[model samples]
Target: MLSTMRSGVRRHSALLLFILGAVLLTPLSQAQQLQTKFGCNMTRDEDGEKVIYGDTGEFKLDGERIEALRWESALYRPTHGFECSIDTSDDPQAEVEQDGDKSNWRITLKDPVAARHQRGYDFYNHGMNCSIRLQRDGDKLHVIPSCPALCGSRGNFTELSVDLKTGECSYK
Candidate 1:
């Protein structure tokens, strides 16, 4: 009876150790496997579908389209558009290419850009026309973009997710 009790305690201790080790390593493994370069906030619409605000890209204020250089006197901008429930790809290599009326935007992460945006060790040029602020929260991101004063006026300063092609804002 004494031996049996001793064996049972040993087994329980082994199980407890296993659980503790797993809990400790889980976060490390998950962090290493994270591949998403989280961009812009995606919200749920009326139907609860995930979506990023697709802005007009034209950068307007008070219903008037401002020039590229006059984008600093503005206040209130909306440029986030990614929703967890509906956002598909967390591709680390998204980029934007101007194609016809809309843009062909792909959010890609090359080593050079990854270091600056992720680690903050390097610097990437903030195009005078627009500035994208990428805020990292653990494995997630709060992507925000602003129309700088270089665009002409204090332009649209919203951090809304804009459809690169249509520049349409998500109405949700």
Candidate 2:
């Protein structure tokens, strides 16, 4: 009889532990509802004309997790190292300035990923000096490196646009 009680107690304890572990390890998505995935569409503007700038991606941010959605295009510049974020607060304004130029827009995200330059940078005076731009309209946040200047005046100044709500990117 004692053996039977011991076995039952052991089984109950194991079941309790298993239930606790399962509850603790369950994914947050399974426990809670997830809103629509944050995304963006990127477009670009060049040479006084609007063009479908190819090869871009969108980023989704949940709390602190950021995921990049890449598009297949041979012309997209890889954004690897840079500092950008979306700030959505009482004041909805996002801007980044480079090469003595300033871009002001009205969309705020927490922290957006950095896109690499299509063409790298010129090493001058031991300081990184590059031309980039900021294109802003309504809920769109676009980042364009002042390219024509970087391309020895042979390339077009590209523009990057992002939808603030969905984090979509489109190169113009």
Best by TM-score: 2
lDDT of 1 by residue, 11-83 (tens): 9999999999999867543332212221233344534544333222222111111112111122222443211
Off by over 4 Å in 2: 28-41, 46-51, 54-71, 74-172
Error of 1 at 153 (Å): 41
Ten-residue stretch with the least lDDT total in model 2? 81-90
lDDT of 2 by residue, 51-118 (tens): 44343433332322323222222233343212222222212223322222222422232222111222
C-alpha lDDT of all candidate models, in order: 0.33, 0.37
Model 1 misses residue 111 by how many Å? Answer: 19
Q: Report the number of backbone clashes for model 1.
A: 55
What's the lDDT of the predicted structure labeled candidate 2? Answer: 0.37
Counting only residues 3 or more apart in sequence or on different chains, how many pairs clash (N, Cα, C under 3 Å) in candidate 2? 36
